[model samples]
Target: MKLTRRLFVGASAASAASLSAPMVMGQARPRVVVVGGGSGGATAARYIAKDSQGAIDVTLVEPSREYYTCYFSNLYLGGFRELDSLAHGYGTLASEYGINVVHDWAVGVDREARTVSLAGGATLPYDRLILSPGIDFVDGAVPGWDLSAQDVMPHAYKAGTQTALLKAQVQAMPEGGVFAMVAPPNPYRCPPGPYERVSMVAHMLKANNPTAKILIVDPKESFSKQGLFEEGWQKHYTGMIDRIGPDFGATNVEVRPDTMEVLIDGVAEKVDVCNVIPAQKAGRICELAGITDGNWAPVIPHTMQSRIDENIHVLGDASAQGDMPKSGFSANSQAKVAAMAVRGALTGSQVFPARFSNTCWSLIATDDGVKVGASYEATDEKIASVEGFVSQTGEDAALRKQTYEESIGWYNGIVADMFG
Candidate 1:
């Protein structure tokens, strides 16, 4: 049978009625507390609540009232999307799916008691916990730069005011001024994100400040879709973007926000705007919960359960699941598998084997899109990639434009799946 949202809601209600017998016997309903309400956390909360038919009580703990997706913030920088278009509210999740949406910071977690402490001084107890706190920058990852200097050199990775700040900095650059980007190392959020931002920055400059130049100081010798990006840069914005790899001392770099100068291997260059994306690790709450292995939280591939605590699950960028790049699509996909597992564990629902998929689409210029994608299945050891595909160089413009359109459709669909 084709499962629609209405049908799922009905099924959930039926399940809840059947489970009422246990509640009448003095047993409590299963409780799930989700921390972070982005692609992973929101989807997990919605699915568990909607599919369980009120058999499970789900609480979502997020500090922000509105979430701005980091996925398409680069497009906002390029003027392809509006800032408001990237923002979403949790009202639908609460009103439609019967979720308890709490707007507060999740400050701590007590695994022993299965409770989450909030900044508002309330403690939420849960039978299962899902943590998808996203990415946080490492301290001292880039010398002379820290969170305090973010105003001067905006990371814009979290996608809100910082995104607007970076865009303003780029647009406000002097004629022929330099825009510098300090790219992060490997194992960061969105493997292709920094490069995509560079592309969008180039696109913006080409239209506004045609003479402006973009400099990339990258730690890695190579990057995701490097060939495709270079080809697009040369074709679309020739001589506009220059990259310095680690061989040229990209790894050993320091930023002086006070002076607007970046030191690359003892050589300093003054830039009109600096975008420093530092080395990243799992969000702070993971460390607080003692579930992370110093950087990222490890999880069982099939269930996305924490390796340290089976009752707590980790999803999205915070999870160190093998072979899956930390993308929103990956997080959303993992959330479904986790939701099913959590339901089965809590409500005696049927559990299915886990399968996952991801696609990362990046726009190089107007109507010029490229993509990389893969499908995976859970193995005894990890989430192994079964097959993959990438956009080839020299693809016709029609295909590229079609690819761009597909990405837009995906954005709408995924957000609906997450919020509703």
Candidate 2:
């Protein structure tokens, strides 16, 4: 059924009213518990409930009531969007889709017992579990930086308040001050994210502090959309951005939060602002559940079922699925596949073949955008990419603008798809 906004609102109201209604005296519904209500979990919870038509009991455990999307957060930094525009609530999922949205952290999981323990001292029994806890930082990934030092140098990778803090710091930069970014290595969330962030920061600096400089210390020799990003930087914010790869001693880096000094290859340089994106691993809950292989949880690509436990499926950045970049699009796509499979297992619904696709669009400057994307299918070994396309180095202004507009449309469509 098509879920129009008006219909969704009405359905949600009805669901809310029915929350107090007594359950059937003898009916036994299969329960599915989902942890983390971001792109993956929320989508999975909605789909299972919507498709099952109340045949299955769906519960979503998320610590935060309001979710801020990591996608398009760079646009927020670039002044293309408002922070509030990125925030989403679970009311629709609760009232409209009949999902039990519990705003609490999932602290533990007992695989044998098939139950999830919440931080609020409640235990949810589940026939199936969906884990989509997203990315967590690796300890000491960046020297002299940890969670406590976030106030001095905001990563802003998680969106929400960190994004606002970074923007405020960028605006408050002194005349011709230096802004440094310690970019993450390969296999991180959103491959094009850090570069796009650099572009957004440059955009802000150009309008506010034209003479300010931007420095990127990257562990990887190359980054996503490298050619396009370099071209845009030179054209729009000339001589303002400099990126140092491993060859330039980018690998050996450290930061002093107190002095705002970044040490690159033993050379100490004081910066007015620092953004350090640390090495990432699966969310902490995955490790607590003993489903992770140190860094990430392994999954059978065809169904997103955890190799460790068939009853539990891991999606998005948490799963070590082959060849798929960790992005909101990837997560949403994986969620649908997992949802279908979960429904098939529980309610005997018809399961479709698993196919997936992802496209990452980035805004370089105002109305200037670029994207890279591919389609994939589940193979015996992995989810292998079949065909792909990327934005060229010398695209026309009209095409770039069109791409930017397309990104806006996608953002709206995706949020609706996930929330409604």
Candidate 3:
């Protein structure tokens, strides 16, 4: 394959004598323990395993055997894609790539010992650790909302059953009823996720319950692709959606799952379905690892290595890397960079300059898609955006449809790149 920044698996590598290796040369091979089986971790594990060619031992620790993609889940809610299509397994990585896939939760990390303790009473030692556990909701972010209340007012941000539950609740709503969403604050996973979800919800409601209303209680004043989403909402689902920003007291929001009511600025509003995407931080395991600065783990942009600990590398939404939006595309991009850096460190392989890129696609209405993307370079400070592009506000139907088609192709390509 051609050597691009995105696909650097087979690119530049120079062999070195065994004396140059980081770990003990004769006793065992250099071991890499990757936490989380999502975009960043999976891609990192696969790339390292494939590129290193058995020079390193790669063990991927993910609780779930079947991983789901949150990228195109909005399309699933809009009925454009099936749930099964978004699900992928670890069989290929385990069987074909010689990766030790452990279907268990990583509960603790011993940085000094370089060992990871799992929930299943297993201790795995490693020379390097990659953390891509994704985001977890901050406690008390939405008043009266927590993990327990998820059954009544589901935060379908994690995909899988939560996504299915939210979809079911929308389908079971009363005719002309309301569907409310509590949008998250800044620096959350998937910047345009909530808006795309609103568009998808509106798409479904317009067909089934035309009089159904969609309400957004957002803390942020403006969001990614605001113009594109607003224009699409007007053209596709006019009068069906309403947004309550900070100006309208959206910041002071609370939910009552027991009563199915959302208190927006102390005003109790009843809703048929509620998706409360609370404030997000790095996964809880990051706290266990003791590497987070505030809510997220800080990483050196060049290698995606945790600033607190050189052996640990943080990726995706859990990282406080600058500029890049917390999206699957961003995570995957970072994974390639991390994979290359990890291999070079462990096996004394040649390392190239770190380059990253990401694109986030949102389906507003049927065959109507909008996107924002950028190519980045690793600067001394952060991952700086070198170039960018976004979908035009007023594009022809053919162009919009083409963009939608492009998104589908991307979905296929990314999953293949990740799982395979």
By TM-score, who's the top model here?
1
Q: Cα lDDT for residue 311, model 2?
A: 95
Q: Candidate 2 or 3, higher TM-score?
A: 3
Across 1-420, the per-residue lDDT of candidate 3 in tens digits comes to: 566532232122212223345555453468899999999999999999888876677899999989989999988899999999889999989766778899999999999999999999999999899999999989899999999999899999998999999999999999999999999999899999999999999999999999999999999989999999999999999999999999999999989999999998899998889999999999989999999986999999999999999999999999998999999999999999999999999888899999999999999998899999999998878989999999999999999999999999998999999889
lDDT of 3 at 350: 91
Better of 1 and 3 by TM-score: 1
Q: Write the per-residue lDDT of candidate 2 for residues 1-420, one digit (tens) a residue.
A: 899764665465446324422233343567889999999999999998888777678899999989999999998898889999999999999877878899999999999888999998999999889999999999999999999999899999998999999999999999999999999987799999999999999998899899999999999989999999999999999999998999989999999999999999999989999999999999999999999999999999889999989999999999999999999999999999999999888766689899999999999999899999999999878889989999998899999999999998999998998999
**How does candidate 1 fare on TM-score?**
0.95
Q: Please report the candidate that would top lDDT against the real structure.
A: 1
Per-prediction RMSD in angstroms?
A: 4.1, 4.7, 5.2
lDDT for each residue of candidate 1 in 70-94, tens digit (9 for 90 to 100):
9999999999999999999999997
**C-alpha RMSD in Å of predicted model 1 compared with the true structure:** 4.1
> How many backbone clashes does every candidate have?
1, 2, 0
Model 2 stretches astray by more than 4 angstroms: 1-27
TM-score of every candidate relative to the true structure: 0.95, 0.94, 0.95
Ranking by TM-score: 1, 3, 2
